[model samples]
Target: MAEIEVYTERYEREHGHKPVGRRFWSFTIVSPIATAKDHFLHTEQAMTYDKALEKAMEVAIKRRSERIIVEP
Candidate 1:
């Protein structure tokens, strides 16, 4: 399995109040190859960091499973 890291970024809207509503959560999967072509998970929106992490992990697992089948 690829190592995954989750990060959160604050979202700022042009026409709204300061801070805005929800934030964006993203994840990056470390590449196994020497080229280091990492995979990224970008979500539409997330209320909390935990939620974002969960979504990212889910996607990573699914992708890993698919890759295993293809490689095997």
Candidate 2:
């Protein structure tokens, strides 16, 4: 289970569409954690893209001490 954050107003303003239904976006944020697997799975079920973005950043900062490897 993933914790999803929701930023409805922000999303609506950006896309000109209210999140009355389903909305999605592909976003990549820096994560200090080695992997997102063990962490809470933040999915659409949990929150919206905007919220997810914020949470991701927060998680990254909180787990900054953890070693992470980025792949190309």
Candidate 3:
């Protein structure tokens, strides 16, 4: 089983400010092992944390991760 780290957050990349009010969403995933390359994935489809988490989980699934560390 592989352990992976996923960082998900919502922010407006253009202004680089907080309290972006659900304007943008992005996530970064990292694996401690070489199960998969560490990278970032961004999507505008996610308006809430649940949606963002869903996408992150998909990546984890592809990596066959059994354990995951998620950060908001």
TM-score to true structure, per model: 0.44, 0.33, 0.46
Q: Rate the local accuracy (lDDT) of all candidates.
A: 0.45, 0.43, 0.51
Better of 1 and 3 by TM-score: 3
Candidate 1 segments whose C-alpha is farther than 4 A from its true place? 1-22, 31-38, 65-72
lDDT of 2 by residue, 1-72 (tens): 243333345545665775433344333333445465544433455455456555555655565523221111
For candidate 2, the lDDT comes to 0.43
Per-residue lDDT over 1-72 for candidate 3, one digit per residue giving the tens place of the 0 to 100 score = 445544222333444553234434555555444334354556656466566666777876775554344333
Give the best candidate by lDDT: 3
Candidate 1 clashes between residue pairs 3 or more apart in a chain or in different chains: none
Q: If candidate 3 were superposed on the true structure by all CA atoms, what would the RMSD be?
A: 5.9
What residue pairs are clashing in model 2? 2-41, 2-42, 3-42, 4-47, 5-51
Comparing 2 and 3 on lDDT, the stronger one: 3
